[model samples]
Target: MRTSKHLIEQLASDLGYEYISDLHRPQLLPEIQILISSYDSQSYSLKEWKDAVQYITGSSCKLCECEEIKQYLLSLKNS
Candidate 1:
């Protein structure tokens, strides 16, 4: 099955993540907010956030995970 952005957005909503795809820099701060909300009520460190991006995007390098002009679909288990 093909997972389009809209499908991802619906999945994100169902998964408790705030979908915000229109970003040029992929701000860590806002992304952190989604991370915090998507997961359980907990504090998210920069390292954990980086790891989350890696896990979600399936990228080896952290840089590859953080795409500047692309909006990605992410899910956090027990978050």
Candidate 2:
């Protein structure tokens, strides 16, 4: 599956991450891309999705707090 840079950027923005120029955190883009591609390939579980979100945001807060992320996870779960 091809990872969309636009989706990664949107996810990062929705998750409240600020980017310097077009560079997201040192390794954030790749991580989010991997997470998205893995999901597209039906290789991720809800738990893994939550863990990745937590790792990316550096927060242990409820995943439901982020609607876009929550919706993405739900889609992954349903698939």
Candidate 3:
């Protein structure tokens, strides 16, 4: 499963005014696209999210591998 556009949009919006936003130029939009495409036909997991990031941004953040990454991140303030 893929992360929703709302999630990605919210992530981008949340980070819009941050310096870390500069860490990932172009922001989460492209990453969102990557997340959706990286979704597995089976089940989505934190591992999946990380895979998606790895697939796109080439990261090793396995915590992001889950479909729940969006919700999980959203739950944290200033994520």
Candidate 4:
């Protein structure tokens, strides 16, 4: 079970951002390439995906595409 923090760190790393663990905030670029790339990866379970979306949406990072990711994840769930 991957925690939200772990997911955020992975996303940051995937996007070429240096994840700062001390801040516990994901340093993400304003690109959605990683999200699109991992859309069909299935590397995480549904619960992990939910947790990640929740964490990203609830965070103070306004630049994040959390809503879009949430919708994508929902589509995946439905399919």
Candidate 5:
């Protein structure tokens, strides 16, 4: 079984995020919220969000370099 750490790294690579574990998940919201916002900026769309969560949870490995994923990690650095 792949460890969570390895899974996160795979997720980052697949999504084009240079680093996913560096940013701390905000305590104010559930970790899933970060995943959701990381994938959708304008509206509530669960496509990318669900894919990422499924990757992290060891359910699937569907990876894509969507604009939303790029912006999400970039926003973390900018902030």
Candidate 6:
């Protein structure tokens, strides 16, 4: 479950100015791609995966996506 280009664009838009320089590290995008891939696959245990998901998804948090992702993760764990 890799992140799509549209999701990256959405995250960039949500993050606004900081995304231009501060958040846009050379490896950030690629790292995020891997992060979400791991997240969707539940590649880590709940504790580890939650931390990773929080770190990655919470970084660009101008929108409600973070909360949504958290909810989804909780559901996955419960299910």
Clashing pairs in 5: none
Tens-digit lDDT track of model 3 for 1-79: 4544333343444445343343254345454444444434235445544543444354455452354554433333222
Best to worst by TM-score, what's the order?
A: 4, 2, 3, 6, 1, 5
What is the C-alpha RMSD, rounded to one decimal, of candidate 6? 12.1
Per-residue lDDT over 1-79 for candidate 5, one digit per residue giving the tens place of the 0 to 100 score: 2233443454455445687653233431244334534433333233544354444343443434445543443343211
Ranked by TM-score, the better of candidates 4 and 5 is 4
- TM per candidate: 0.27, 0.34, 0.30, 0.43, 0.24, 0.28
Best candidate (score: TM-score)? 4
Per-model tally of clashing residue pairs = 2, 0, 11, 0, 0, 0
Sort by lDDT, best first.
Answer: 2, 4, 3, 5, 6, 1
lDDT of each: 0.38, 0.46, 0.43, 0.46, 0.42, 0.41
Give the per-residue Cα lDDT of candidate 5 at 35: 53
10 residues in a row with least lDDT, candidate 4: 21-30
- Report the number of the highest-lDDT candidate: 2
True-structure lDDT of candidate 3: 0.43
How do the residues 1-79 of candidate 6 rate in per-residue lDDT, one tens digit apiece? Answer: 3444334343445445335233344345454444344344322234443443445445322223444554453333211
The residue-by-residue lDDT of candidate 1 on 1-79, one tens digit each, is: 2223332343345545575342223433355446334442123333444554554444533433223212332332322
Q: Which stretches of candidate 6 lie over 4 Å from their true place?
A: 1-27, 35-43, 59-79
Candidate 1 weakest ten by summed lDDT: 64-73
Residue 37 C-alpha lDDT in model 3: 47
Error of 4 at 6 (Å): 4.1
Model 4 ranges off by over 4 Å? 1-6, 20-30, 59-79
Error of 6 at 79 (Å): 30
